[model samples]
Target: MNPDNREWERVDEKMILVMRLTGAGKSYFIQQLTGMNVSAGHELKVHILYLANFVAGTEKCQVIQTSIGNTDFAIMDTPGFDGTTRSDAEILKVITEQLSIIRLGYNLKGIVYLHRITDNRMGGSAMRSLDIFEKLVGEDALSNVVLATTMWGNVVDIAAANRRDSELREEYWGSMRRRGSTATRFDGTRESARAIVEQLLGKKAVVLKVQEELVDREMSLNQTAAGVLLELEVYAEAEQIRKRLEQLESELKYEKDSNKRLEVKRSQRRNAKAFSQCAEDKKTMKSKPGVEVKGKLKKWAESGGKIGLQALQGLAAIVSISFGIAGFILGAGF
Candidate 1:
């Protein structure tokens, strides 16, 4: 691919900006998305720059640039770690700087707000700051606002954690909507993070698999394309019908198995009740001798309990045979 004419430069067609709070996996996110490896191990000493265009007697607009991929991408790393620099003041300064850039003919593309997945809870401070930033940046800027939740690898239950991340996105997006700020979720796993990058690039991005974690399966082009087409109610009706049929088959198999289990349980329960009744009859026979035994046997015979009581009755026949043999041998030997 020729570097100059590459579609990759489309990122530069607009003034793209990434605004993230401190330690929100911004560095890792940038590395994964751009395939750029910085600060790998040795201290090569890289410097990030924030260049300001001066107006009158004061510095007005500033552009923060970081080197990622073959491109020099502009980004704003907010909530600086300087002890004296408060988060509110840094955000205020960045807003002022961006406004100055807008006046000086720089068009803004979008903003990505980096959020840490390590903290399951969103800080009120961050929420309040986002509100202020959105109000200053205007509601159109919300289209540019992306809430990136990072560090998914540390989660124990990946599926549950992902669900939590999704819930958080819904809440965050709803909050943004309430403030007239549009936002989307950028949960930084290999799959989702790449998807978000592709959306931002406005094209299906070619992804090089670096490491696989948490992604259950890799979806194919045909599947994804088909899915997207289906969303538009396009010409994929046949494929949808096939998928529904497969789902119905699976459901039918499940119901069949469930019914079989219910029948087995019912049979077992009936046999158990019959066995208990037989034991009670035996106890009555011991207490009341011949009369109770005859009455009880007659009742059981009349009640259609024959098949159910067959197992217990077979044991009784064995006992009677053993007793008859004992009696005959004793009489002959004596």
Candidate 2:
């Protein structure tokens, strides 16, 4: 059977996207909502690198069709922005391709972005994922977004969790909340999952920014808002590494002890390797469609050849990518 024709047969069904960082309970939540026998576990394992293929049971996007209170909708399970085995660019390509397929038959009714409430602090990967998500949704579709916090049952310290929740709303999620995005909790229950889905059942389906950019405007993936944000993030990381290498060089020149000097030299070599990797990543990005290398170089030169610290102040932490599913859901893979 033709997949496109099969999708077209379900034209009346509303579409919803489930997105977040790895280990954020996306598959587990979908299992609760659709009662699918999806793979889910509490402990993140090293072998579980890719969410879409290993966890969600398919490399291509899978739409699990289910009815919620007489309303038939399809929930699309997506790969995380921080996949251990996949670059953000590769993941974005997969997502945008699937989205383009869905655009032929249906519009997105809502998006559910899950976060771990148990996390005391948001890491760099989480922050970068959130930034890219916002750009993909655009300001106009903020009302259709649900910022759902998961793993509430795992929190032993209720007060600290609440404080973290408040901090997320006030600092990280403030602008989104003010612009009509909602904050909710997922308590690892079927009822809670249904309730979250119910919130979007009545909302009017709208085209997401990515859909508009890729399908409507016919723009290349590298030219979209989310793509630009990812590029800037990569550039910022490279600049920071460059600055650190310069500092290490200065410190090595003034060091008097041989042991300290050896340590500094070791650090320099490590930083140099990392900088080389970043340069390769930039080359990959530039090779994508619609990226003009000369134009980007000109822009970099115009900005005094340095990325502003203010642009990426809190994103200095190294990303530690992991993947897992909550144990509350079914333990078998689909």
**How do all models score by TM-score?**
0.42, 0.67
lDDT of 2 by residue, 198-297 (tens): 8887899877887777666656766789888777777888999999999999999999999999999999999998788678666655443212222332
Query: Candidate 1 residues 22-103, lDDT tens each?
Result: 5667656655554434332211122332112222222112223333233333333333222232223322333332322222
| Best of the candidates, lDDT | 2
Report every candidate's CA lDDT. Answer: 0.38, 0.68
lDDT value, residue 57 of candidate 2: 27
lDDT of 1 at 130: 50
Q: Which residue pairs in model 1 clash with each other?
A: none
lDDT for predicted candidate 1 compared with the true structure: 0.38
Candidate 1 wrong stretches, greater than 4 Å: 1-13, 39-73, 80-84, 175-195, 201-334
lDDT of 2 at 67: 67
Q: Which pairs of residues have clashing backbones in candidate 2?
A: 41-325
